[model samples]
Target: MDQNLKIELGKQGVFVTTIQELYNWGRRSSVWPMQFGLACCAIEMIATTMARYDLARFGAEVFRPSPRQADLMIVSGTVTKKMAPQVVRLYNQMAEPRYVIAMGACAISGGPFKQGYNVLKGIDRYIPVDVHIPGCPPRPEALLQAFIALQKKIDCQPLTGAERPRFLDAGAQGEFPVPVPGGHDLEPTSNRGVWPVPITMNRGE
Candidate 1:
């Protein structure tokens, strides 16, 4: 729709919008994030919801305790190898159009714990991450920025055609596999469908 035309219509007390636009508008306006936190970053995540930051302005302040009722997952903190399965399981339980925001350095790349044998290098190995906020323990403002970014992402998603989000595509995988603990580490290491194992080419010595 043309901007000028929309304004003209508004002057006449008329409104115009398509089903796709309306649907996207509703989804972006009410993204309920799952109330799950992993480490220190969770503190900042909590602060983001407080009066100072007021995350409610973006319509994401209501954190759902159950995965089934949430559309967004803000992975805040370090994910340990032992807890990887539980995180993936919760993600699988979320309904279609689900999104994830990898918050803080730990959740994105394990931060200072990246070398720890128990810390999972990154949560992206098990599930798709829609946005990543880089910081040791990102302040509440950083989280709000990431939230807005996620909202913009949701708003731009097409309802149909090749550009449509995976959830809308009937053939796309509905659930991600939950990793299990093996003797040495999480079985399979990563979800190839989500984050493919990096291939390193070698030259003969």
Candidate 2:
């Protein structure tokens, strides 16, 4: 503990805690999210990081454009089948102790477009999600609440060898499987005949 933070009691002291708590506290305080935004919900997400809401208040102000540097990814809009591979690829690129918050109904369940053949039902089908924010396009307040919830969840995590996020601690979880184009719906490459071949159309004919 810092000298200023150090304290003692003649009879007892409840504040005394482990280094793991200290580390978890720090980690929870300063979560850096990726700067990747998908659609309309992105507008509300941006608002949360702005002067009014000030994500800095929660210690998560830096939004890195590179997934390698980011600690959280807020999937803020619709996730179409065409975008699923890219989404999973970005998630795989993030460093350990990473998190993902599915924001808005579109990212959560495809929203009103769930009937659309090209829309992915939800992002969680491909990558593990940490938080799910509701609303077709949730207001900035909702996004802030989601971040706060994630912080609370992070506070419960262990910093030492005892426990950690299984995805990063136990062993390599491997990359999320990217979808391949071949049928009415995209299929995993592991499935037979799912691999796609290049097609060139001769419009002149």
Candidate 3:
């Protein structure tokens, strides 16, 4: 059974896995999540990572404080108009092949907060949501399930997953744009390029 169970490095004994396999394995094994928890659901997310739940077992325990180091984002609560821009910015900063888990009903569909004029209907409105855990404030067990689902989704994706990650996917062709607080509501920033701002005021100069 040892023959079938273990890998054989034929001669030098120094040989092991290939570079790409090793790289991919490291990525698949250690999914560092960005530090982002918004509302009541954030508490549940913390519990899921604590002793009893131990999200570390699935290789996603290292919750990074910096978006630059993270590849996974668990949007664990409500997304209001004011917070939507910040959320999308974080998503933009994350590396390619990044995954998002819309945890709890608020992050998924705004839950009870949906009726509030300030609440964003869904996080999907700003960034692509990979998994959605449906509950007003989903339980720790439910968050664990979301991780499993995310792992499965990651496994199915190509190694070089996203095509032209930052710019192209941000949808220059009129899709979701980073939101900004303007007047009484949020305004999309994609059209700012076309705003008639003077390159240089010449006549008086």
- Residues 1-205, model 3: lDDT tens digits: 2433235543536445555556556766888888879999999999989999999998989999998899899998989988899998888788666778999999987799888978887787668778899987899999999888877655544434364333235544433368889886667522334232244823431
Candidate 3's C-alpha runs over 4 A off are: 1-24, 160-176, 189-205
User: Which structure among the candidates has the greatest TM-score?
Assistant: 1
lDDT of the candidates, in the order given:
0.91, 0.81, 0.76
Residue 194, model 3, lDDT? 27
Q: How close is candidate 3 to the true structure, as a TM-score?
A: 0.73
Full-model lDDT, candidate 1: 0.91
Alpha carbon lDDT of residue 22, candidate 1? 95
**lDDT (C-alpha) at residue 35 in model 2:** 98
Badly placed stretches (over 4 Å) of model 2 are 1-15, 160-163, 189-205
Model 1 bad stretches (over 4 Å): 201-205
In TM-score terms, candidate 2 sits at: 0.82
Candidate 2, 1-205: lDDT as tens digits = 5534556532355566677788889888889999989999999988999999999999899999999999999999999889888888898889877899999998987898888988887787677788999998999999999999999998888754646665446664646677766676767522222212224513321
Which model, 1 or 2, shows the larger lDDT? 1
* lDDT measured at residue 137 in model 2 versus the true structure, 0 to 100: 95
TM-score each candidate: 0.94, 0.82, 0.73
